[model samples]
Target: MRIGLYATGQAGLEGIVEDIAAAERLGLDSAFLPQLTAWDALTVAALAGPRVPRIGLGTAVVRTYAQHPLALAGQALTAQAATGGRLTLGIGPSHREIVEGGYGLSYDRPARHVREYLQALRPLLRGESTDFRGETLSVSGTVDVPGAEPPPVLVSALGPVLLGIAGELADGTVTVWAGPEVLGEYVVPKITDAAKRAGRPAPRVVASAMLSVTADPDRVRADIRGRFGTAGEFASYRRLLRQQGKAGLEDTVAAGDEDFVAATVARFAAAGVTDLLVSPVGTDEERERTLAFAARLR
Candidate 1:
């Protein structure tokens, strides 16, 4: 499996770039940036792409509701050009709370929204003009970015319907808070089957997990829970945890000694994950240790 660093962009824009460079030096496959409230992920990829030379630069996801397909396509293509064809664009319709409460956009019929979003977005990325009209989205335009190849697109698909949409329309799926059991028994099989039915190549399964290599694993886990416990309250994540026979977000974290951490990562690979994005957790020293150990896996 390909191992990548999940750069949170917590240390600022330059810090993010520096992290990407460090990941490349460590022989990691990719460095994925998240689309939070701060820095724009695509813009960061464009900036880091030139500096980091060889490693893949990607977005863990950019929320689909925020940008129109035409605009997103243009920006993504620009980033792709800037990155010299080394950008993977991951997009998703984030949860209702963030969309409705934060962005003030209705989150009804998310599956339909994603399906239409892809219908319009994909063709535009390929440098083809798109004229698509659906219940949720409509577009009539093309994105022209010279020397930019169409980057592979991945969707954050959790449920079955969205999985089908992702498999048929996008290249693959990106997931979070899903354990090996859910990946092996539910997610992988469901998306793979959808891709087969659509006559597409095998889909990529990119899983993100919080990991730490620490002597006091329980303390690390407690810290993770304190910081990210709200993630377990999200409906989608709650369902995923239940599917994995887990109770909360902390339960999904891989925090332990070197051997235990290695075993945890191995389980994810054994479950057929194509890419693993490790979000190192705990103290500064432990996080660095975690990244070093993950680099060896690559």
Candidate 2:
């Protein structure tokens, strides 16, 4: 399986872009930049695309409700053109809390919204002038971007309904935080079946697993806390971890000996993880070292 690092892109804009450049030189496959408190995913993709041509660029998952389909498709086209077709667009309807509470957007009928959004967005990305109106989206005119190749669109699918929408509309599925049993038993099958039922070819399921690594296990755990305690301990992820046999854990990180870390990663691969995105969950040094180790594994 292919392996690489995942960064939160918090280290300043210029600094983060430079870091990505450095990582590309290190022979990393790709980088996934999250759209958290940061700017929109397309903004970061545009900023980073010109710097690295060999590496793949993708929005981990951009919030669907955050922008109109035309606007999103336009940004995607610009990023794809800027990157010379190296961009992968990962879009999603984020959770209810984040949508309704954080962004103050309606969180109802997310599956329907995703379908409607893609229906409008895909044609525009293809440079096809058309009018589309659905329950959750409406597009009157085309986004005119000459000679733009639409980047492969991936969907963030968790529930089955969303998985069906993802398979029908997207080229791949981007996963997160799911452990071995959960991925093998629930996530993968749902994605595969959804694609098959739609008569679409099998879509790639890229599973991004978070890890905290160091020479010392104790220090590694501390690093995880310092880097991810505020973010990783989100209630929803905690519950998911529990469902994956890591219940009551303060953290879901790889912080033990080589045997331990290797065992964890191997389990993910064995569980059918095609692309392994190792999110370093500690000090920058620890993060780099983890990437080095990940390279060794690759």
Which structure among the candidates has the greatest TM-score?
A: 1
**Clashes (candidate 1):** 0
Q: Give the Cα lDDT of each candidate.
A: 0.92, 0.77
Instruction: Give the C-alpha miss distance for residue 249 in model 2, angstroms.
Output: 7.5
Candidate 1 is scored at a TM of 0.98
Which pairs clash in the backbone of model 1? none
Candidate 1: tens digits of C-alpha lDDT, residues 97-155: 89999999999999999999999998999999889999998999888988899999999
- Tell me model 1's lDDT, rounded to 2 decimals: 0.92
Q: Give stretches of model 2 more than 4 Å off.
A: 215-239, 248-250
TM-score of each: 0.98, 0.91
Residues 229-273, candidate 2, lDDT per residue (tens digit)?
A: 654455556657667776433356667555777888898788776
| Candidate 2 lowest-lDDT run of ten | 247-256
Q: Which ten residues in a row have the lowest lDDT in candidate 1?
A: 239-248
